[model samples]
Target: MKQRPWINVIATEPEEIINTIDKCPSGAIRYSIPEGSKIKENVSNGVGNINFENTNLSVVKIKVNANGPLLIEGPTIIIDFEGKPLKEGSKMALCRCGLSGNRHFCDGAHSKQSWKPDQIDK
Candidate 1:
């Protein structure tokens, strides 16, 4: 039988894996540090509340990826056409080519298209 695909990260530095997992736009990747480890956990408080009010995360920035989706940074809440909340996250990749099977969120569908940033007409 064919084994299912998986990720087995082997690194000398814990921060290397942590930093990469932290950049996952869809939150599909996660990590848990073992007890007594030196690496500090970057998580919310025990009650599951993120203290954004005291932090300098007031600014939201959107970066247009080259021939890809729009990368959103900072705290955000994605809403639908009727103002209904869809998803919330610190980072997100929104579909720009409208070919994403996941709709608002990018699933790397733009890579399969022939669209280019320099092209004036679709």
Candidate 2:
């Protein structure tokens, strides 16, 4: 088997995540990118809140939407539905609501369809 390049992206740095776990914090670090998953960076959807995540791969800037997709960046992985390796790039979008037919990845459907729950006050 080829030793394919891979990077594990934990919301916080793995080191920090580990420390938090050791401290019995409410955080986890079992982050791992399976062989086949959609990966991307710099997506625009309306909700705006920047997040920086660091991994062995690279630094990623993400945006948090009250109810929207997860915008991701570099050190990304694009995989097929049948668990096949696609491409590794530096920009893409991932679905958060699990409504996209594309599944696992975001095709801008969250914005194109404007599919959010009726509760906006939450």
Candidate 3:
């Protein structure tokens, strides 16, 4: 298995890799087929089968977790207070509770604090 800063994936057959990538909940893994590759066309990229080649504008989607962080998916750039890019990626979990030790990012601290979406003091 190859370990990246974000996730670990086992390098294997193309079909198997695509299958694994499809299971990723964060949408962190993406694959592109080469022009002449033999991969089948029916394989799903797990992102609504978006045809990136035919699109001019990248679509970004954000999902607010029930009682947790905000899930960001698609091409994104996260900037810090100084307006400098802190990170760039296809998926990210941003802290909404302000209790994360890793500011701007979630570290599951909200769970520890029993945070709720309707809580008065976030």
- Per-residue CA lDDT of model 2 for 1-122, tens digit only, reads 12232223445654443333333211111233234434222221111212323345457656654566665554656678788876544445567766667666654456655647324425
Residue-level lDDT of model 1, residues 8-89, one tens digit each, is 4663466766666665654434566666778665542211123223246688889887777788877788989999999876
Best to worst by TM-score, what's the order? 1, 3, 2
TM-score for each predicted model, relative to the true structure: 0.65, 0.37, 0.56
Candidate 2 residue pairs in clash (backbone atoms < 3 Å):
40-91, 40-92, 41-72, 41-73, 41-91, 41-92
Candidate 1 segments whose C-alpha is farther than 4 A from its true place = 1-6, 9-15, 25-39, 42-54, 117-122
User: Model 1 clash pairs?
Assistant: none
Q: Which parts of model 2 have CA positions greater than 4 angstroms off?
A: 1-57, 78-86, 112-122
* Best-performing candidate as measured by TM-score: 1
Tens digit of lDDT per residue, candidate 3, span 15-90? 7777766665544456666677787777744442333331433787898876778888777889888999998766
Candidate 2 global CA lDDT score: 0.44
Best by lDDT: 3
- Taken over the whole model, the C-alpha lDDT of each candidate is 0.64, 0.44, 0.67
lDDT of 2 at 9: 40
Score candidate 3 by TM-score against the native: 0.56
